[model samples]
Target: MTATKIAIVGVGKIARDQHIPSITRNGAFELSATVSRHSGVDGVENFATIEELLAGRPDVGAVALCMPPQARFDAAWTAIKAGRHVLLEKPPGATVAEVEALIAAARDEGVALFATWHSRYAASVPAAKAWLAKRQVQSARITWKEDVRRWHPGQEWIWQPGGLGVFDPGINALSILTEILPQPVRVTAAELQFPDGRDAPIAAQLQFAGASGETVSADFDWRQTGPQTWNIEIETNDGQLKLSSGGAEMTIDGKVMMQEADSEYDGIYARFAQLVAETSIDVDLAPLVHVADAFMLGRRIVVDAFEM
Candidate 1:
């Protein structure tokens, strides 16, 4: 079978670090072209914009959109309309409604649409989900704190209105939670802390309630400097489950149950290939919906100015 000709829509840090490598290693895809304003992949045809790339690369059968959530909807809509499969990075779109529209467009075009949550493909996430499915969850706590300067660097778009700030990483935890838990959850309360002069929040605390009456709380902060942490702990009828290192490790009752190197992007590309082959859409709106809910219902507080 001929490899699917895929074009990457963004050539930012994520596209270079993860998406490029994953695509190169996966036999189901070929890096045929790139759409970027400033950078391009070596040995691939480059275009200054998505419109130009779409028009030029008629052989391109799919597109992987690694652009910011704010710009994702337009590119995705265009690709779906062009009858090309699309793979979207986490936090699919700027809003829930936009992703819903993309779903409808993909269906109308009869093409695959995959909204990938890389954290969901972490090595231990499936095992953690399996373990929780057999047990009764009593309560859950999520703590995801990291230094934005170290991770995001000089990306100014992150502080903009639709950039999603702290929720960028927080949504990853929500993705894992939504996938592993047996019942659906809804946000009950949220407190968002925004740094002065920034449009988006820098930290957030959220309370959630599951249909089974289970309570889950999350604390997301982008101000941490030392000892960055990404952890989720859950209490069950049998014992306690803890997933640390951003789902890279899992422990039960303080004993390590699973630990391994993460191949999240690899898994993401593999799944995208499968979705493209099946001509199915796998865009889950649960995680993005929860983020939107938190922003809608949460109270905002202005804090100190964050200088990067």
Candidate 2:
């Protein structure tokens, strides 16, 4: 099988840390080019903008957008219009509407559009989903707290309006929740805690309701100092299910079920290859929709200023 020649439009931390390595290891893809003003891969061709990349490398059949959410729509739309399959990083776009528009544009151009949720591809996520499918969920709780300085470093875009702040990492848990739950859920209430001068929140508390009267609550904070936490616990009639280490480990009522290394982006690129081959679309907006609802219904609270 001939590998799909692909270009990555952003060369930031995630691009360097996850996307590039995954693409290199995946036989289905070749990292032919990149679009970044400040950086590029060692051997790949680089362009300053998406327009230049799209026009210069017409043979590059696919594009992976690892840019921030605020600037993703235009680049993705440009790639799709240029007849290239597109793979979006999580929280596909700044708003739900723009992602929807990209879906339509990809359909019109007959190209694949994959809005990836990397956490949903974790090693134990499938097991959790399968177990939950057979049980009656009593309630669920998500406690996702991480130090932003450690994960994002000096990336100031996160504190901006479209950057999603705490919800940036929080949405990963939401993605897992949407994937594992037998029933759908919607946000019922939220309290967002914003730093004094920031446009986005540093912490958030959310309440969700399922159709069967099951309640879900989430607590997300970016101010955690040590060890970090990314855990989801669900109470069921049979037993308790818990997923920790961002879904890399699963425990049921105190027994270790599954544990494995993080290989989510690999699965993402693998799925992208399949989508590109079939010329299909696989954009799930359930996670993004829950974030949108959280913002719309959340009450804002001012907190102390944050600095890097």
Candidate 3:
């Protein structure tokens, strides 16, 4: 089969580090073009905007939108209207309603649409999910803390409304949780800590309840200065299962079961290829819905201003 000609929008750090490399390496896709206001990929056609890229590269069959959540809806809508398949980064849109709209548009246009959660494709996530399938979950705790300056330095949009702040990374944990657990969960209460001058929260505490009566708690903070942590621990009827390093490693009862390097974007591209071929849409909105629910029902607290 001929490879799908794909274009990338938003040539930021993720597009350069992950999306470009993954698409170039995947046999099912060919990197045909890029659209960015500032950065450009070498050896590929580049355009100043999505409009120009779409008009210039008629052969492109799909697009991977690596832009921020706030700007995703417009580009996605334009692409779907142009009858191109779309692959969206996590937290598909700034609002749940926008993603819902995109879903309808993609369906109406009869094109593939995938909202990728890279962490769900981590090396050990499936293993954790399989292990928990037969066991009873008692409780779960998720701690995702990192230094935003190190990860997203000088990205002012992160502090603005719709930037999602710490939830940007926290959603990764929720994605994994939603995937690995045997039953669905919902946010019951949330406490968000916003910086003095920021519109988004820098830290958050959330409580969740599973359909089977399991309890879950999440703590997301972007203020850590020392060792970074991305971990999820769950107590099951059999033993304790811990997924650390953002689902890259797994342990049961203090015994290491799995550990490997991450290939999240590679898996993302692979899944996108399958979706495009099948002409199907694979978008799980549970994680984003939980986020919206948190914002809607969460209590607000003022915290110290954060500086990068």
**Which candidate number would show the highest TM-score if scored against the true structure?**
2
Model 3, span 1-308: residue lDDT tens: 89999999998988888998899889999999999888898898999989998898889999999888899999999999999999998889999999999999999999999999999999999999999999999999999999999889789988889999999999999999999999988899999999999999999999999878999999999999899999999999899999999999999999999999989999999999999999999999999999999999999999988787
Question: What TM-score, over all chains together, does every model reach?
Answer: 0.99, 0.99, 0.98
**What is the overall TM-score of model 3 with all chains considered together?**
0.98
Specify the highest-lDDT model's number: 2
Give one digit per residue, the lDDT tens place, for model 1 in 153-203.
Answer: 899888998899999999999999998887788999999999999999999
Give the TM-score comparing model 1 with the true structure, all chains together: 0.99
Angstrom error at residue 107, model 2: 0.6
Q: 1 or 2, which is superior by TM-score? A: 2
Residue 243's C-alpha lDDT in candidate 2? Answer: 100
lDDT of 2 by residue, 153-262 (tens): 99999999899999999999999999999999899999999999999999999999988889999999999998999999999999999999999999999899999999
Give all candidate RMSDs, comma-separated: 0.8, 0.6, 0.8
Clashes of 3: 0
Clashing pairs in 2: none
Against the correct fold, how does model 2 do in TM-score? 0.99
